[model samples]
Target chain A: MNIEIKDLRFTYPTGLEALKGISLSVNAGEQVAIVGQNGAGKTTLVRHFNGLLRPSAGSVWIGDWDTSKYSVAKLASRVGYVFQNPDEQLFSRDVLTEVAFGPKNLGYEKDKVDALVKRALSLTELNDQTETNPYDLSPTWRKMVALASIIAMDTPIVIFDEPTTGQDAVNVARIANVIAELKKEGKTVITITHDIDFCAENFERVIALSKGEVLLDGPAREVLGQEEILAQTYVDPPQLTRLGKMLGLKATVINQEEFLNALK
Target chain B: MAFVNFQNVTYKYPLTKTPVLKNINLQVNEGEFIAVMGPNGAGKSTLCYALAGFVPHFFKGEISGEIEVDGKKSSESTLDEWVLNVGLAFQNPFNQISGAKYTVFEEIAFGLENIGVPRNEMKDRVDEAMALTGIRDLADRSPYSLSGGQQQRVALTSILVMRPRLLVLDEPTSQMDPIGTREVFGVVRKMAEEGMTVVMVEHKVEWIAHFADRVIALNEGQVLMEGKPNEVLTADLLPEKGFGISRYTSVARQAQQQGLWKQKQLPVTLFEAAEGFTSKGGGGSN
Candidate 1:
């Protein structure tokens, strides 16, 4: 299902305007990455998709359902929002229970919930830790469990908040693969992230936000390849892009692997 | 004398029988930038806490052998005294800060004020600390209002204002984005340049290798190797230590695989790697 936002404006209880007159649309099965500096209203914008935050003005529509009219629990089945801190989202003792929470809440039968939990656990590669207490696991494992929980909910629109924050290269690669799988399963993936390398590698389109406005939106390579625009958004473009600009090479190389291949 | 010393130290948790750190003897001189790197649960954070005198003080455990900071035995000193000599920043920034209503300025001043620094000297010290961490503008802002990067800076400035002789940071940039990571490391490198001893437990070896005076690798609670960045970041050794080499370093390795760059030295940064590639003219599209 496609998502449409029309003139969305949000103001906090303290009279602070977080998002102002924003409008955008994300198509079905489109992998779009939202890039911005700190306090750029990235989080505020994504929260609207899942009805976690109702806009003060304008409207957010997921297909025919108006997000403002739907309850969080009702919207959650259609839009899965995974928070940045897994500790904030995961409260169950074991991975199985954590994954099952979402499916059960969606009114799935007990047998179906159990099957969905098992499937989600296997997808996140946490099958071996099904019985382990979440607190006893590492931060990365906890994050995977959180992702499994959302997967068990089986939302068509999945949003990830900085999924690669503290991950190492291997774990990052694993998350990237998971994202790829999400795309293969015909899910619309919207990610708020600052890992420019990961964005350049995995995402096809990019939207750059600054001071509660959409500054740029285009192909990930074009958006992230511009050093001045990236610097303006408080983003450090991938190193290879900098190297490319410094050497007067074509402004297309974004990673070392691509740079090496281009050199060849 | 070394500012911090761990001599054949071994430690185990209360209920667990296995040792978390084993036969580790290391010395950190005053005003040095040292990075401790390893995979998950490699006892790096354990070493940081032990050096900060948290093993027996904050955590219940059995520790053997000697660990000292500034010639004072770690077990003998109180946490308050340890705070004076060595300031520690945890991997999670949320757990480090205190005072819900405290602004960034007030948070930094809390430690200095507790130590009974003169009221007249507090403002200047706080300003300097804020300036050092590039959070001077954030002094008036609430700690909760800042971004992850800005919040981490506030936490760092709070520790830096204490002017501890040694600073122990556990993955200070783990919770930050790429730009934020660069900013934090820039502050850390500047601190080391200004003659502050910095021991960081980090996983991003590429960023650390550029500024670290020494690199120590740990595995399963034991020191696997310790040396210069080039010596420790070698392709043959890093993979064995369970570290995925930096992409720049990996590219250089692949170039060597294809008989391009003939140099044996590993390039840790994009600048260095690019220079190496260009100077060799072996794979320079430019």
Candidate 2:
């Protein structure tokens, strides 16, 4: 599942033009991360891919299917969205049930749903809490349950909204591993996040959005190396990148390995 | 007595089997800025509520232990009276917004109104608070129309306008961008400098390292470690206990294992990490 948008524009019912004319494309099985300040039209753009919001102008094509012709439910089978707030979407009593709900809703067979739910739960390290009430778990665990719920859908495209927010380092590592697993399975992963470090390490492509426009879109190193543009969007480069800059390293370094290698 | 003291404090929510906070003993001095760090369900937020007099007062929980703030006992004072000295701003800015008010300025003044602040004085205080948080231009905008970061600033300004002696913030910048986070931190730093005590719960280890006077690592409702920011944040056992240590510290530790880093102390901030890695006998430029 590829996503293509051309001259996309959106206006809320309150007369707020959230997204100006914008254009972008995501290749199938590609991992991309969208970053910007709060209310910078990142959410407005992603909502179009899943048909949650109709484009006021222009067109969004999900693998040649124009989003305008499809309802949100119709798009759900192709695109799975894990909301930023897990509480908003979590309605089931236990973890296993919550994970099973998505596949069941998509008309999967009982055995298939059971298999997918087990796989997702194991991947997210939530297998131990399968029978536990989701609300009884900590917010971090609840976030994992939410991710497992979406993963069980087995969509080719998965979209995560600020998945690392409010998570500790360990939980953040877990989310990154999940994304890696999703990519390994040949699924396209798109994340809108404030965690620049996570984005630097995991994503191949980084899109910086500012005020309903694409500020920069390129490889992770190139896009994140432009600190001035990122400053305009209120994003700082990853810690290692900043460290590399401070050390007068000739190249941009994103993680500890690169930082040490650059030092050598 | 210290400005704030918690003596063998433990609390459990209504009908809960286990206590969320267990035998937590701590103390804070006046005008000191303390940052509390912990994993989820570690009782950091409960500690904030105890400081702000909401744990037992608002929630009506089973609390055993003594909490003192500025010579007042938490269990003895009414919630209405306790809030006058200790103001709290939490994670969700939307939940903190007072829907009764039309504009940001009026929304900030709503707190003062509830506590019966005089009309003339309320206007002056509200303006001052707005100026402090850099939200003066948002005075006339509807509180509901502002962005999440902007609304968080307004929520903070509402509490600051009350002129509380102590401010308790729980991940107040989670919804903010880098610039917004810095803006809120700048305001909080200024308040601490001006003799207002503060206890903030945050996950951004880098920011906390720069601003906090002390760091407390909480785990499973207990204080796992407490001391200067540098000592607690760079502790070897932080990661094992599920505390969110700085990435710089982790990276430096890894480099040390590879025989690349020579610093005696691991770095918690980017500046420190860079200096340690670039200084004499260190890795880079060797």
DockQ for every model comes to 0.53, 0.60
Write model 1 residue lDDT over B1-286, tens digit each, in one string. Answer: 9988899999997766788999899998888999998876788888898878887678879999898888899877788888788988877677788865458899889888889999879999999888877778777777876666667777888888988889999888765666667777888888888888999988776688777899988888998889987688764767765665676777778888887666768677777777777775455665
lDDT of 2 by residue, A1-264 (tens): 789999999988767788999999899999999999977988778888899899999999998789999989889899999987788789999998899999999998999999999999999999899899999887789899999999999999999988988888778889999999999999999999888998999999999999888999999999999988899999999988988888888999888788877777
Look at candidate 1 and tell me the lDDT of residue B285. Answer: 60
Off by over 4 Å in 2: B99-103, B137-147
- Of the candidates shown, which would achieve the greatest TM-score relative to the real structure? 2
lDDT for each candidate structure: 0.83, 0.90
* Pairs with backbone N, CA or C atoms under 3 Å apart (clashes), candidate 2: none
| DockQ (model 1, Cα) | 0.53
True contacts kept of each: 0.40, 0.65
- Using all chains and alpha carbons, the TM-scores for the candidates as numbered come to 0.94, 0.95
Point out where model 1 deviates above 4 Å: B15-17
The TM-score measured for candidate 2 stands at 0.95
Among these predicted structures, which one has the highest lDDT? 2
